[model samples]
Target: MLTAVMQCVFRILPAVWVLLACLGGASAQDYEAGFKAFQAGNYAQARGIWRPLADAGDAQAQYGLGVMYERGAGAIAADLGRAAHWYARAVGQGHPSAQNNLGLMFAQGRGVQRAPVRATKLWQSAAEAGHLMAQYNLGLAYYRGEGLERDNKTALRWFRRAARSGLPDGQYAMGQMYRLGVVVAQDNAKALAWYRRAAAQGHGKAESLAQALADDGWEAAKLDVPATGDAKVEASPVVPKQQAVGRASPDGSVRSAERSSPAGSGTTGSGQGVRADAARIWLGSLRTRAKARQHWRDMLRRFPEALRGASPSYSEVDLGDNGTFYRVLAVGYPHPEAAGRACQTLRAREPSAFCKVMAGGN
Candidate 1:
């Protein structure tokens, strides 16, 4: 009787494991379906799918519900109070975007009592967890001495981090900093380079600045002016120009640039030192070079530390009649476990950001 009972227990264990695995896959599929619905502008369907999952303690679904409530997307009415409630739940589960959004609400005193100090702390936490907007917001706080001591140097460091990650606002702010000689020495050339980068992303102010500098013949010989209809203009390295600087803008108004969303695609880094046979995380594929570049920039902004040593590379794949697609990849992960961990962190903030392990060269 003892041997028979032990055999039955062992037989049921494998079945239980299979059931659990199937449940996990089903959950992932449901989440993905909801995300696709959201992206397709079917917010009602997304909310319908996510509501149950969120109530059941799914962090990503909670974050999605928070966003829908905050934005009043689709059939939902805009409700900051409900947004805050869902955001609180998501952040408690370590959702990075939820933390950032809740921090913004606290900073602005929307649906919650005004608490700049608390807001700053939340932003700092999200920034450290690889939320790009939080990093930019924390940089702004440091620059303006909001809920923190004035520290222009520290502000510049954070701004540079965002700028290097290809954030247009950060690039523009860095240009303003260089132009005004705040913390760093005033350098017209460097300012122009940063502005050009920002302008490429459709920043209005940066476009005006770049055009003005070009028209004035200031460092004209050092710059490359793209002719009309050019497919691409390679930007030369930006070398800073030393000159006397002013302390403030002509209008004397506090210089603040609005935050811009990351582009759909962008590319960064060359797969130089990565071993050819190592595993890597495949991020996404885009139809255009511009979009590929935007995606790359977005990934860098969102995963700066995790991808510190990794390289961003792309390979073109031909799809007859549909044109070519650029496959974006983060190369240099030593194993699938490391890639999986980084993917989890990225997906916390960007639900649509896909990650899968692949051999380095493939």
Candidate 2:
């Protein structure tokens, strides 16, 4: 009889443990129950289920209550004041969603005073915590110069982060930037790639853009040129003129007559001891195509012998929010090895030449 009783008690223990979890949860049964009730349109049931936990300082419950008040779900009249109250409670506990929602409220002055600065601060806090919407909002803020200095670079960084996280809106924004060459150089192939990604997720604008690019018969191309046979080096080094300093572009890049000179840039380490294999060399990455072309002309004048047979050409690249730039390369080498030798020789000959081999193209 004693052995049988002990067996029954052991079996009963699991049931008792389950019952205990439903009340508060080592199983989190109540919170889940509230969510199900809310989804089922039983707003009252959800609110009732959440209130106790909310009063006991559960952040998720507080956020749920805030939503309920804001949306007026389940017979609860929409109350922005109450919503703000609950959101403030959740935000006090550092809830990211609550922070983002409250930021919206602050931005629109719904239940709070309109404050762009406040909204931005809240968005930044939530954004840094990896909240996708917050990241997107922050990107817009920077893009539009709202509550902060307009910084295309910062905006691009945030937009890239949000897009990489699979936000459809962010993906669409990236596609637009690519298509329009807002910051990066316009590349239809890349624009189509981004648009297609968004379209796969049912982004309407992206769908149309992707279709348009497809209609245009755009095809992806290799971004880099392959290495070729040894290049002939024939250009003689010449004296660089002081008057050949190129005009400053908006992004602060300047091309010198000697080429590859950025304003306030110091000489990179001399790789004289190391083998260099530069088939091509970089002159400067300038803001605009015209600026790059001007720099190339300056280079030709500055290094007549060094660029004897070289023609002016530039490669375009989009740096997202940092903006689009064109890299003007000075080339005529038999091969990269020759180019590398020339760059090394130039650097050795004139420390101010700032000669650097193109590591590779983008």
Candidate 3:
């Protein structure tokens, strides 16, 4: 079941590589047809279409075949050895998702020998590229000192990074930390918020905990800025009170919603939130959504009139291995013209600030 679920996170290739591939950076041979077939459950056709492409050195195809073999989805029976081979090929070509999945294989001693160090190294590579699962896994490794030195600070950083992107595992971890009052300050409000987010994403443990929290009278929370104690504890990632987690895609890819959100969808994070149309002025992508809040505050103080009618929210951009960034969007504009005018005014005032008019939705 774990292997099957990991298939949902199969393609974490870097955005630059995807861009390069689009701009003739790699072989132009089409492989999406195979993906379509797989999505349609035509495993035989997917295998047939992928074999030649995989053999011809198409990294994406190689990764697909690796996944197909791992799942025994095609005409061929389950072949862990072959799956590892294909994953290795894709990894050699800088496929971040393949690196992450293969790292799991190493960690579990499935196709390859158990090598926690190797697994951690692969996870580090993928995590650095913005693979949310990899980031979570690497954070766990850091928390445990698994094949690496234990660094709670580093672990917290990675966990927050993954959680900010709305990874269920990472969000759950955040909830646990807050609930336990371990690394972070104990804040039930923040814990409840994180739990609700993870629970909405179909995390079973989170669902159970969320129900418990609600029964205990906790509600969907605002940013619960906890007091800093001896240890400098920051608040959990801000998930707006209105954000609704997207349902999983029909294609069964866990990150599909995330993939589409950045292309002007106005949604935020991996699978978190409804498309917020009130958020019209896109302030450009920053490394974290936390930064979006800070940026918004900065803009409000610097140019109050320029942001005449705007709310606080963001559109998340998850770039597989390229990393995740949040586009700070100011909500409450009535139309494109109004939003455009606001952005234009802001631009006129601060020439370097990135401000784009993103129209609203229902």
Per residue, candidate 2 scores C-alpha lDDT tens digits across 96-147 of 6677777767765767887878878988987788766677678766766667
lDDT of each: 0.57, 0.56, 0.58
Query: lDDT of candidate 1?
Result: 0.57
Give the lDDT of residue 51 in candidate 2.
Answer: 91
**Candidate 1 on 117-235: residue-level lDDT in tens?**
88788778876776555666677777766678868788788777656655555677777777667788888777777776655544567768867876666441222322101222211
TM of each candidate vs. truth? 0.57, 0.53, 0.55
lDDT of 2 at 217: 86
TM-score (C-alpha, index-matched) for candidate 2: 0.53
TM-score leader:
1
TM-score, candidate 1, is: 0.57
RMSD to the hidden true structure, all candidates: 20.6, 27.9, 13.9
